[model samples]
Target: MRTYWDLCVGFARTGVTGYGGGPSTIPLIEYEAVKKYKWMTEEEFGESLALANTLPGPIATKMAAYVGYKIKGPLGAFVAIMAHIVPSLIGMLGLLGVLYTFKSSAVVKGMINGVAPVVGVMLAVMAYQFFQKGRQGLGSKWMIGMSLFSLCVIEFLNLHPGFVIILFLTSAFVWSTYKESGKTLFTRKQVMRSREEEL
Candidate 1:
């Protein structure tokens, strides 16, 4: 059984230092869960990430809850979720205090302006990591296609993210079932191959 301290430390570290946004924080969470703790294999982490993306709420919190629940059920989930959120909660409060006191500080203006470059870097890294992880799980060429398709739909069509995710999740289920049943619903050549195998 994993101890509370172990869970707290691992997730707290992620929460405390995961600057920028949830996408940027994911790599940090992956490092602790998949690398430092051995809580999940890389493949499992990838799968978990996919599943978490489908769920409602912030991806980081959902991920922490899933990992913790896997390790120790409901109680583990509670601890992990709290650990993941506590740092952000404290940081927000601190920032609010700073903003209140430094409403007119030039230092604050400089800090905000400087953060854009760093955030851009973080987001770039996050996007690249997502590409690599998706490619590993879903082939290099196909990953690019899917990424482009998702980007276009999200940006051009302006569809809600939840709707898009649900659409893909349903598509994946149907595709997987077809593959498992040896049914070639989408290709005439594969249908013929399955028939030939039967003979």
Candidate 2:
């Protein structure tokens, strides 16, 4: 029950407060999932974010569902998603007409413009943290090389991000497998050499 309530409140806070939609809400969601609730470590959350990006649909919803299900199963996922979206739904129902009418007002425009910078800073901070983590895990050279490669494919070649993530994941899996097999073969050769020396 406490878990359910926590899930509700956590996602609800993000729903009510998150401005500029899915991408912008990420930092707030990270706070609840990682810092507030301690549901996942930062590294786990980073991996989850990578996986979530590879899927379709709204990033916020996917993350809410994932965290919810991870903590409390399918019902928790239902609760989390509801809490995450209901506030936005109600606001949309109530404020859509008003916002549309005042969309061109200078005050409204300025308010949005101001918020945009805050959101940009939030995303930049998150990206830098992830960059640091990647550097620690992959080493600076590999991280920078992969970053450049990913940038080229994503920004210049116009390849989809989901495809790029999948490509990297596949490459990592293959490389890991090769390394394990090489170690196994090396151990076998060492064993054979010892046996020959004994003979």
> Deviation in angstroms for 68 in model 2?
0.6
TM-scores for every candidate against the unseen true structure: 0.79, 0.92
Candidate 2's displacement at residue 124, Å, is 0.4
Which pairs, if any, clash in model 2? Answer: none
lDDT of 1 by residue, 153-172 (tens): 99999988788889888988
Q: Could you give candidate 2's per-residue lDDT for residues 1-199 as a string of tens digits? A: 9999999999999999899889889999999999999999998999999889988899999999999999999999999999999988999999999999999999999999989999999999998998899999899999999999999999999998888889998999999999999999999999999999999
Strongest candidate by lDDT: 2
Q: For this target, which candidate reaches the highest TM-score against the unseen true structure?
A: 2
